[model samples]
Target: MKEKLGVVPFWQGYDRKEVLKIARIAEDLGYESIWIPEAWGYEQFQLLTEIAKETTRIKLATGIANVFSRSAGLLAMSTATLDEISEGRVILGLGTSGKNVVENFHGTPYRKPLTRLRETIGICKTLWRGERLTPEQSTLAELRHFKLAMTPVRADIPIYVASLQPKAVRELGRIADGWVPTFWPYEHFNEGLEWIAEGARDAGRDPSEIELAPFLGVVPIEDVDFARSALKPMISFYIGGMGTYYHDMFCRFGFTENADLVRDLYVAGNKQESIAAVSDDLVDAIAICGSPEHCRERLGEWRANGMGHGLVGLSPGATADSVEFILKAVAPA
Candidate 1:
């Protein structure tokens, strides 16, 4: 059986043309989607629009749009316009990025994230519904009372929320049509599903209604050691200094010792040490690496274990040949 897979290219440090090539390749290979992430790098809308022009069938999404950066109504407008351009193949992946990006980079305070996200989705839907966004509804983002100037071509576009914390996951279950989780090892995937189910039950929504799409880092290199080493920096970065939120989440997922050591090494300016400290076991559990056969086997396991939709994050060292190999190996039938 073919598993659902989406390509998530490294947005920064790569040539724009190459990224577009990967998207076209994935579409040609029958991958389900291509997700573009916005993280202190390129804007997603322009890039996604450009990508839409290149690919014919694969769905496009904002691996995530930071809720703190743009108002909810604007997000709705952007999604509507992109959906129109993509001919209704756009998925709005929304999230509250770490405090560092929100406060430091965007100059916006990250406040009441759970409520903010819930309200943001509601506001977006309200605008899409062509209803008047009243001041009473505007209390969250200070949204003004107004209706969309034009009717959206597809008002019911899917909205997926990127979440890790239990509360956020629960809320995602309640409101989002899908969930995008990072650092979710296969062993702990069910834990997140349960949290989402709890919220679905609370809201009287079917748990199956929400799609489970996890971001997976894949390193398909001939040398096992090289693949593991290549992924260590990224794994260590997220488990260490990305933010206390992610660090705490990793600890809760039963990586307390590794998380602590990685964070300590990273903070002490021992960046190399931090990378070295990321054990092969942790990396293997969270990512797929090694030979092509091994990576294909893991992809099968992921599909069997409820990976309905997967966002594949390629290693920085991935070449054109390696990416094409992955596309064929994991292509959805």
Candidate 2:
């Protein structure tokens, strides 16, 4: 594996205080960036602010801040502020988070997700350039006339779109500075590459304009079975309980029976069975687990198939010391 890795330490069983420590260690180990996720836990930018205060070299990304939770103006302002504070080390990774999270958690309707994402991107860029929002772009008549007061540190802050569906995935070719995807099956993954190229051609943009930066889950323990055990529950949760997207994706990847069983068992409240339903083969296709050597080999496989930067999140049950060891063992060579 080459040196194209980024660290994301917001997985289950991770100690909150240890996140900054890991970020510092990763920067020292020559990792490219650190991506902080915002779901139900700590706010993404605040955590990145702390990391920005602690480390100086590595880039900082939002991992994903969804479009629905915050208005486009707010997202632009906060990201601009963070970009200034971080001294131009910000990558605003945007996504349409699941319907449950947007509606149930944020109390916002999840209609027209792709449209909101496209609108949010356009608005954020417009504000970043110190330009007023146009009448057609704003939902409110009053919203169109105001521009950001302070100049952003960088006008073109990199925006990575983390989209799963084909329609939004196609949009990535036209607009994204980087593509942040997870759970794209290793085999037959070229299906997505074709879509990206098709999108670029449609938009009269070269596909090379978009960077390939996908997420890959990893369990760095030496025991393959133990690592699989740790990874299965998370996979099951995403495939079954999280939403229909993951299940539909796996089905699209030719795992219809497996995906169906996992969802059915999970919906029936048989979590253990749902976890058990996740096969080791599927895990291998989607993640890198097992011994350090095995992880290194699996990473090489993905890179061989066109994975660029590796934004790896260790599986649950990783400790500070264990993470340090894993980082060293699997550090890009």
Candidate 3:
């Protein structure tokens, strides 16, 4: 059985051409999709357009474009354009990417985030339905209710929401087509699923309608030693630097000591210590990075537990050869 496993490129600090090579290789290996993530310097839609030029079968996603930065209408518009370019294989992955990113980076206040999330999804769906986006829906008095000027490739493009908190998880379950959770520990997997089920039941929607697709930091490397520490630096940075969310969540995942130490070490500029402090238990809670056989085994765990895996490049070693080997090793079929 093909598992429909997807992959995320090492978005930053890698050669652009190389990322495209990863996408092409994933396509060739029959992976399900390539998730593109936007950061300080990169535009996700532009990258997806380039990836579209390179391959035809694999699906594309924003991996997550935060809900705070862009208006829902604009997100809908840009996503629609990408879907058209990709010939109707685009998933708009939305997230409330912490307060620091929203206020410090985007200069947008991260206020009423879940409310904003609900409104955003409603507006996006409304505009895609060729209906006017009322100011009541958008809360922008200046911008009148407007329908998309151009016809979208698919009026109902699949939407996935990256959520970590209970409220956000339940919210996405209530509305989103898929749940793209990050740092979702494997232990409480059924706990998370139940939250979604509760939400679906409350909303009178079928729980199975919402896809349980968790993000995994999978990076297959040849060197036994390096492979062991593959995702440490990136994972440490996220736990410490991104915001308090990850740290708190890790604590909730029963890794309080490790999470605290990693955060303190990373924040205090003890980079090596912080990375070293990322315990194997914490890492294994969310990532699968090792040899091909090892990755296949760990990925099997995720799939058997009833969730699709989105392999985010936890290790920056997703070079041409490694991408090919790992994709083939973890091929859905």
Q: Each prediction's Cα lDDT score?
A: 0.84, 0.85, 0.81
Give the per-residue lDDT digits (tens) of candidate 1, residues 1-333. Answer: 457889887755655677888888898888889888888878998899999888778899998898899988789889998888888899999998878889999999978887888888988898888888877764565656788998888778899999888889999988899989887788788888899999999999999888889898887767889888988998888876777876787788788898899999998899999999998888887888877778888887877767789899976535667688777765676
Q: How many pairs in model 2 have backbone atoms within 3 A of each other, for residues 3 or more apart or on separate chains, i.e. clashes?
A: 0
Separately for all candidates shown, the number of backbone clashes (residues 3 or more apart, or on different chains) is 0, 0, 2
Query: In model 1, which regions exceed 4 Å deviation?
Result: 317-322
TM-scores for all candidates: the values are 0.95, 0.94, 0.93
Tens-place lDDT digits, model 3, residues 1-333: 557778886556655787898888888877888888877768888988999989899899888898889988789899899889989989888987778778988999889888888888988898888888676775532457679999987889989888888988888778888888777786677888888888888989998888877877765665645764867888898898988888988889799999999999998999999999889878777877677788878778887776864555534545777667667766777
**Order of candidates by lDDT, top first?**
2, 1, 3
Error of 1 at 141 (Å): 3.3
Candidate 2 lDDT by residue in tens digits, 172-227: 87777888888888665577767888888998998867777888887777888888
Please, what's the RMSD in Å of model 3?
2.0
- Model 3 alpha-carbon drift over 4 Å, by segment: 139-143, 221-225
In model 2, which range of ten residues has the least summed lDDT? 135-144
Error of 3 at 211 (Å): 1.3
